[model samples]
Target: MTSSPVPDTPVEVIVDLLTKAQDIASYCDNMISDLFLAGQTLKMLIHMSQAKRVLEIGMFTGYGALSMAEALPEDGCLVACELEPYLKEFAQPIFDKSPHGKKINVKTGNAMETLKELATAGEQFDMVFIDADKNNYINYYKFIMDNNMLRLRGVICIDNSLFKARVYLNETTDSNGLALREFNQFVSNDPRVEQVIPLRDGLTLIRRVPPCKITDDEVFRGVTGRFILDRMRLDGKVAYVTGAGQGIGRAFAHALGEAGAKVAVVDLDGAKAETVVEELFLKGINAISITADISKSDDVQRMIDAIVSKWGVIHIGCNNAGINMNSASEDTSLEEWDKTFNVNLRGTFMCCQAAGRVMLKQGYGKIINTASMASLIVPHPQKQLSYNTSKAGVVKLTQTLGTEWADRGVRVNCISPGIVDTPLIHSESLRPLVQRWLSDIPAGRLAQVTDLQAAVVYLASDASDYMTGHNLVIEGGQSLW
Candidate 1:
């Protein structure tokens, strides 16, 4: 059986310890076989399953046990069993030296007896690794099934089922080989679990199937329709909203908070962010505030880091921090143009990139960028050339990332809002300009901050699971005029 190499530092250390133990076991002729699993393989299995409680039938020298334990979370536990008392004694010292040693509980006794005791205690495990006596493989399988020791949909991994390639030999008299051959067939015929993977050394992975409750009639009715409102609910989800201090971004923070998300209000103005977060708390929503300049990469990274350090994962990101500048196309200074792009385009890119990393690793995320209706059509009376161009670039940036990350489980979309009744549009210098643009809007009124809230919630929820790479236009027929 070929072994996969482990390159990680922790796995490498375990491999070293296993090699030393293998030499000792061979020199002593203790009949303690060095049929230990590859460190990388065991770690991968534990991590992929997110196994909190693991049961290892054969502890051996603790290499596999240590590897699995190290992959678990701080509160996770591993119960290990070994037939030889000396093997536990030999491995305990090594485990003691590792920080993850506390997670491993080594039990020395007859594995069958230990299994029976665990079953009687009603203990369940997320995963069970069997690498003990080959002859009793089938018996261990039956015990786990009969006692309900494994949780539903849990994993059962059997190692060394090939018996050194002797299982394929029909005339082999080896008792272990014959037993393994019989065990493989027994598991194959069992309908409760589906034999999933066959890896090195005849390693077999069996996943217990949960009972199917949905019927053909349910399928015809479209099961998703029943939970339409529930699907939109973001209970227990964590959301980060940039520029949440005031204006449209503040409205988004409130909307997400009301929809059951724990909101992180991020703004360059630390006081403003905290004020908004305090208001959210008074409204019975969980919230926090973070100060960061999105244009600076270090600040943006720190913002994401702080949120993840506190919440463990980021489910939604709203890249809304931006600046606006109104200047004639010919009279716009370089500094004015650069500052607009820095916050509007560069800042948005940095936030998306940072949040994208977290989302890609989690395999599920939603990112909504704030584009402007000026992206579709330049404002008639406004002379903000830089603002219009920067927003247009945002639309294309969203489309590019949306297409690239859709398959990776993260959806990127942008919202282009029309003239909104915010401080940004009601400034003393823009009052005349604002009134002139209102005549062009068929709705006859500037958009309210609340008008954009529903659209943001819809894009953030699972109700938009099938949508991506599309700019959701919230303008009230102004672009048409």
Candidate 2:
């Protein structure tokens, strides 16, 4: 598997910037908005550190407004314009509570009219963000320019430029798309502003100048999305990985252990258990082996008991052990169906039940369940009715339990992967036929174990704390239909 991203100064610097922003937001007593905007602001601050004065043309509940203001230098100032009169009362409480309230001016009234007045008032800003009135995007940009409020080298960000792919269609059109299309073309030929990078929705980054040149830095700057996956790691957490013996299980055990998690390497095979422990030891992560079939109630209870006895608490529990059987529904005897469910579904139930009890007590936990893409949509060429049905059960089980326990702090989520290139699929007897079956996949290939690793880590980490009761389908978009 590939190594995790290297720790870098950029990441830390962004973190520090967010720390200050969060402090400001918290100080203002708008912790909710601060908490919500923290991630987004940290990402934006990473792009342009030299940014000072900022103008946010729309301040709804003061989230984006306060976030940008918190990132600016102490000498920097931010101006926010809100069209609604009562928003000041709604957002004022948070700003008044914030220590950096002095740095921001929230102007109440129609955004366009207020922006027009800012131009008349001879106000200039180094950075401007326009996220108001979708149909009036072009109008907002023109007004900002005609007033000469944008300084040379200043950047203007226009949000929601994509309109959820609606703008790209030639038919079933919208006035919003029409206006956005005109704005995109107008900016393309305009003597001022360079670079437009579409994020979710879209983010157009424009640098003001005569015959504006799109610098490599600006191009890179517009790719402002936080590598969200990079945020998952045990930097200072603990994890328990089941079936942590051979194959993909061992890989996951080693990965989490190497990433600083104190791993509980578990398996039904005693020798394999010890082998994983040795591997984790070599990697310098604290580890212990427990030989137990995860599906057994007695075994799961002992595992949990051992874990709590040693570590005092569990942070992440990965329910990942599963077996496969290939048989037509007619040929698949009741015995075989029971055997499949015994390990896949029943085992998952036992483990989650045991882990859920502990996690519920702790009041904060992440349980990452492995549910194959078979749970989302069935593969066309094969029929493993029992396996597919069991996996689907796991998906709903996660969702149901997640909802039941959400208010208590334990978040349960599942990952559904498409045909993964595991040892199970690569067996000498099966590889040839499996390769032929892979042709039906639009990605033209099977997924790698490493492909599932990130999703597992995210579901088990703080990055996905607010997410639960969801099946994160990672099947190369195979189930798109």
The whole-model lDDT of each prediction reads 0.88, 0.77
Model 2 per-residue lDDT at 470: 90
77-124 in candidate 2: lDDT tens per residue? 888888887987877766666665567788988888888788888889
- Pairs that collide, model 1: none
**Candidate 1 ranges beyond 4 A from true positions:** 1-226
Q: How does candidate 2 fare on TM-score?
A: 0.53
Residues 1-481 of candidate 1: C-alpha lDDT, one tens digit per residue: 2244643544355565555565656563232233334655888999999899999999987888988998999999999999999998888877787888889999999899999989888999999999999999999999998788888768999998887889999999999999999999999988778886467767889898754455545343334633455577888999999999999999999999998999999999999999999999999999999999999999999999999999999999999988988889999999999999999999999999999999999999999999999899988777899999999999999999999999999999999999989998778788888778878999998999899998888889988988987899888889988
- The CA-based lDDT of model 1 is what? 0.88
Model 1 lDDT-worst window of ten:
28-37
